[model samples]
Target: MTGAATGLGLGIAERFVADGCVEVHGLDITPTPDRVVPGLQHRTVDVGDAQEVDDCVEAILTAAGRIDILVCNAAIMQDRHEVLQTPDELVERVLRVNFGGVFNLCRAVGRAMKDAGSGRVVTVSSQVAETPWPGMAVYAASKAAVTTFTRAFALEMAPYGVYVNTILPGTMDTNQMRDSFAGLGRMTGADPESLIAAKRTSMPLGRMGTPQDAANLASWLASDQASFSIGGVFDLTGGELWSRS
Candidate 1:
């Protein structure tokens, strides 16, 4: 699992461990800590670098003998800015980590799974990919690319018994979410608390999602229970995407 050092990725990694996965390997650009959840091995890796991702996957295969499941969840949401004001470098960086990272890991691990004749890939996208928001152009675009890529790749890999699916999370209460909102609040001169409260009120379910909400669906997709499922885009948005005020 990429980005497993924190936020939604960490929650998913913890869930896998709890589900009795033999080995749960987590990759993040962040430094590997001395201690993580039991049964999870943390590694420092930049998924945006294709060579690094390939090397890491190869190492996992060499050590674990096989990789049964893969979760491509590494991503970044830098400060929000309108398209015209967004710098070229910021766009490139976001695309590299959010989209390129997914491509690299999926291609490398998908090949291995194809050869093994079976695997499960769960990618975390965002509801914003489909429901656009002002000042989130780059982040939303990157996730949109991931959503489409996963759908196409699923078709190509289905014959090999590999299932690929994406989870679209909406307003999850993760560190990244809070940080992004806080940053946006700073830019707009709005109190971060007010922004968060406004978001909560907008949700049809009356609350933002939890990381565990995403983890539950991801866990099912990664398990045999979802064997017949393929190329699915599961929404864990609490109906916020379709809410009518």
Candidate 2:
């Protein structure tokens, strides 16, 4: 699991450990994660760095012998900035983590799964990839790119028995979401919290999704039950996507 330190990554890792995954390895950029489950082994890994990702995968294989399931959830969302105001460096950084991380890990782990002739890869993408948020063009594009690439990767690995699928989660109530939407306060002339609350209440479900909700679906996708499904983009947006403009 990538981004296993916090937010959805942490939540999913916890769920996997609690579900009795033998020797779950959680990878994060942070040296110390917010929470450490007893069974999940936390490792400091910058998923954006291809060399680092490769080394970490090798190490995990050495220790665990085989990685049956790979989860790609590491991503970054920046403060909303219109394309005219965005810096080139910011675009590159976001693409590096949001897209490149998935590419690198999938290539590395997918190779292993192909050789083993059986494995599951579940990726966390965003609904914004399809909806295209106004000021988050790069983030949305990165997500779109990954979702497409993961689908292609899935096809290539299918004959080898490696199933790959993506999760398109809607407005998740996380610290990252709050921070990224802070700029919405400016556009709405309301405080960020108020804007977020209003958005949540306007959702068809009357609430935003949570990390635990994502974990539940991701867990299901990682199981043998989902083996028949590959290259699928599962939506967990709490009915928000259809309701949104």
TM-score of each: 0.96, 0.97
Candidate 1 TM-score over all chains jointly: 0.96
lDDT over C-alpha atoms for residue 2 of model 2: 91
lDDT of 1 by residue, 17-89 (tens): 9999999999999996334688888999999999999999999999888999999998998788999899999
Off by over 4 Å in 2: 186-189
lDDT, candidate 2, 54-169, per-residue tens:
99999999887888999999999866789999999989999999999999999899888888999999988899898987888999999999889889998998999888999998
Please, what is the whole-model Cα lDDT of each candidate in the order they appear? Answer: 0.91, 0.88
lDDT at position 182, candidate 1: 88
TM-score of 2: 0.97
Can you give the lDDT of residue 107 in candidate 1?
97
